[model samples]
Target: MASKLISGGLFAIAFLGCLVNAQLDTNQTAQNIHDPQPQTPATQSQNTQSKSHPDTQNRRSSCVVEQQNKIQCGAPGTSATVCNALNCCFDGTMCYYGKYVTLHCTKDAQMIVIVSKDATIPNLDLESVGLLSKTGNCSPVATTSAFAIYQFPVTECGTVMSEEDGVLTYENRMFSQYEVELGPRGAITRDSFFDLSIQCRYTGSTAEALLLEMNILPSPYPAVGFGILNVELRLANGQCHLKGCAEEDVAYSSYYRDSEYPITKELQDNVYVEVRMLGRTDPNLVLTLGHCWATSKSNPLSRPQWDLLINGCPYREDRYQTKLLNVGSKLMFPSHYRRFAFQMFTFVSTGAADPSKGNQVTQTADTVNPTYEKVYIHCNVAVCQPSTQYNCEPRCFRKRRDIGESKTFTSRQEDRTVSSQEIQFVALSQSV
Candidate 1:
């Protein structure tokens, strides 16, 4: 009985131990399958919810992926609206910061976040206070146009000089001349003479006759002589010597015989020719401060076209009105001078009444000689109105005498949609 009882105790102990091992295994399996345990977010696998999932490798690489809840990381192309939305923040460029977002903790135990379209913010070294205190320009939009050297100063002898040549003396006063010592007997006229000497030593042929032409009639001429109206260099002998003169005898010493001598030889030497003319006092001799616009040849005048007023004049009768294009002047004067020069700057508009509006506007820039009066300009007109809109025709031509020689300059630009009602014009002259 004692042996049987010990054997039974040993078997009972083995059975109990087996039952405890089986219970422990059952509890572990249950815990793995159905235990309601809390999971740390860091250890949770968002893609695959499994106990053995590799959570460490599943984190998003970029903020875009995280925001989009996608695993792929890269810049989105145009096809991707979300990626394009992010791109809209940039100025059609790829910035370094566009790739990812970084988070950092500070020394004060506080977290600081910085955002930028680029990896680096430029000009950040500029002081914030300095930037805040800066001011900016408050003007109309700026533009640039083609720079030009329209005309230069030339001697009465037709010698060209940079603007630096002629000394800008009493840019005022009525009667002034280039104080040069020269002899006389060249062409000297009173009704159209000037008070300046063009060192004309180029005319190998002496002026045979001093002809006088008058554009304006002066009343009650003094017995000595009628004042000068205008003058020009009639002939020249050389290419190098000065050729034109536009001043009066009082402007220089009395003319010597050499000045009036005729050119005999046809040699290569350049000759100088002096032209003396008398000029009248022009009360309207003030420098124009700004330039005027070209004329609109298409527009006609409100008044009737006059009949052939002067005999032998062409039957042509059309006066196109013009308006001002630009509105500023380049000269300043303390007072108006008695003499000046003129040039035409034509304009084209839809409602011009005078076809000559382009040549009508003038400027008082001392172009050539001070004794020279307002240079007469010729304005020719074409069709005032074309059947098609935006059609352009020859509107105006600015004709002036370069010294005593005549020349014309045509405007290259066409007026676009210029309204007749808005055309403004100002003549380029001290006197109208």
Candidate 2:
């Protein structure tokens, strides 16, 4: 009876063990159905691509920000993404448009001649006995120092004109550009006039009917102030840091302001500027940026002013010079930009910043440090070829003087009577 009881207990233990093993197999199968296997890199990428929009597809391959996916622009106006419908850049009140092309600039005693000096116009002696006139296009060239007046955002270009258009526009002409070429928070300044003069000439028909006409006046007269820009380089806790000239950009350019990344070890000593021109080589005409001041009690037009640091020291030649330079300083140019109009590159190498001295920048002499290899500066000048689209038409715009009812006359108007017949005239009536 004892041996039969032991065999039955052993059978019960074996049956219970089989039931537990079967339950374990069922749990294992359920876990296998819910748990996922690790994915291969290719498989993970495929899944990620499936989630992205078609416009952003293959984004991993390119670094350029794809703009077409967002705002679509067509034509020149004040409301789209950019200002100046032609996509031309604005230099204070002036407009610069069209792709860059080469120009040759030259200065002289009579006039600043810029063009293909090699280019010539035909005299065209038609053998007809009469006053002759020849027309040939001339390029733009001159040295000037201007200021960066407006800081427009990529979003508020066209509509923000009244807020950003600090300079005046021409009554007869309007701009056609829209985008600012200064990059995200970039600014532009130019001085298109080094020396200026008003000219008058006679054009019309009939000996005594001719009249005089003057050239068109330049808009927003070549800035009467040197635009000030402060660039600083400093080392904080053994790390190299750089800064732009404008502290105000931070408030407007939050996108770039947050991108103030530290420089790598290799490029810590190098710096760059959008475009630069050494003010002068001889004695180095030193003038600070941000010039343009007004103190009118009735119509006050106050502007930023910078010190005219001549020869690394404050220029005492003009005591009033220290005060805000109300007028843009004359630009001292280099041999490369001596003649013809030529736009600068997108980025150019400039002097590096100092790492010491608390890295502080101010206008006072003690704070002024010009030891860098290149300074962030500009010329009070602009240039363009005839084929280019920029508004570089010589300030020589004029219309023929009007000649009224009396068509027959014997001598030039407002001049000594020239019955000598040495002065010939064509009988043509013009409306200016």
Candidate 3:
């Protein structure tokens, strides 16, 4: 009985152990279905690296070629795929040789020629073509499998300098050009040879310097009517008596210096005014002086003004003291120049009662305390192209037209208004 009981106890323990083992297996299978195993540290790091550098890892390196290295690599009109198959570079326009040879100018005006270490250009002699460096040698400054760079200064590399028509030209050589052939030793052809002509041209800096020296200001008026006509109104200088006021002589003088404004003049002093075209030298064009007047203020439209010229002629009130000078007839100036002289005077007040002496006023008193007033002279000038039917000369006493008449007496394209610098008139002084 005891032996049978011990055997039953052993069977029960064995059955319980099998049931525990089956429960553990079922839990393990359920967990596997719900959750996946986490990745290892090594695997996660590898995945991140692949995502960051996917393009870099997949793309092949491209060949970098300079413009000077654009020697023909294949026949004309070769496709990009064919060019790649030949191990050449394509710049979307042409197939050119890369990593073979190149010639270009440096920023410092130095010329550089580079050749690859694997390139072979038999019978090519740079020194023979006078392309030696300043050190009188053809040694490479740097050498590697990809590049053998040779540098030569533009001034010392057998360069020629010449000037023609004010243009400076610098060239490597005229007849002996830089040439090289790259191919097998005995199979070089015309297409395999590279020829380059290095040259540089420079217009001299004197033109810009001259312009700076002139310091000419642009005209305030626009180019209209007769096309860019420039008119100048100036007071005649002392040199006026010499040659009817030549531009160079009157340009700088004490009487009408450009640097001096508000020129001082005494009563009854002859004020010579010159009207001329600045750049137009056409002899057929005549300058005509029209309505000229003087105002107390700088504004031409100011009140209390005195008329010196009317209808291209001297005003009837001041005709005795105001007269047009024969500038063009003197042969000292071009036909586009006109001049007139008038005695400097002030206007009489309306109530001063000068009906007998005509409304003009002149200082006859030799008073010690002289009154001075600022005056500005304005003139209407026109350039006329003289022909059979057109006359630029002014004819007095023809007819008096009514004010605001639209009919023009002369045939002219247009009339321009020009004014002179300020003039200070001394009323009671006799000195000019």
Q: How accurate is candidate 1 locally (lDDT)?
A: 0.17
Selected candidate, larger TM-score, 1 vs 2 = 2
Error of 2 at 351 (Å): 25
Worst 10 residues of 3 by lDDT: 13-22
Residue range 1-432, candidate 2, lDDT tens digits? 000000000100000000000011112211111111111111100001011112322322211212221111112232322323222233333322211111100011011111110010011111110111111211111211110011111122221111223331111100111111121222111111000111111112100011111111100001122223211211111212345443222211211121232211110111111112233343222222111111111121211112222211222332223221111224333211211111211111111112243221111112221211111222222212222232222221122231111111211121110000010001111110
Ranking by lDDT: 3, 1, 2
* Cα TM-score of candidate 2: 0.12
* Tens digits of per-residue lDDT for model 3, 181-252: 111111101101112234444453211000000010100111112336678777765644564566434432
* Candidate 1 residue lDDT tens string, 1-432: 000000000110000000000011112111111111111111111111112112212321112221222211123232233322222122233211122111111111111111111111110111110111112321111111110001111121122222223321111101111111111111110111111111111112210101111121100000111222232212222222244753321222222233433212111111122221225244322111111111222232322112111111212221211221221233232111111111111121212122254322111123232122111111221111222322222223333233112112222222111111111111110000
Ranking by TM-score: 3, 2, 1
lDDT, each prediction: 0.17, 0.16, 0.42
Task: Kindly report which residue stretches of model 3 are placed more than 4 angstroms away from their true locations once superposed.
Answer: 1-227, 239-255, 260-262, 328-333, 354-371, 398-409, 427-432
TM-score per candidate: 0.12, 0.12, 0.38
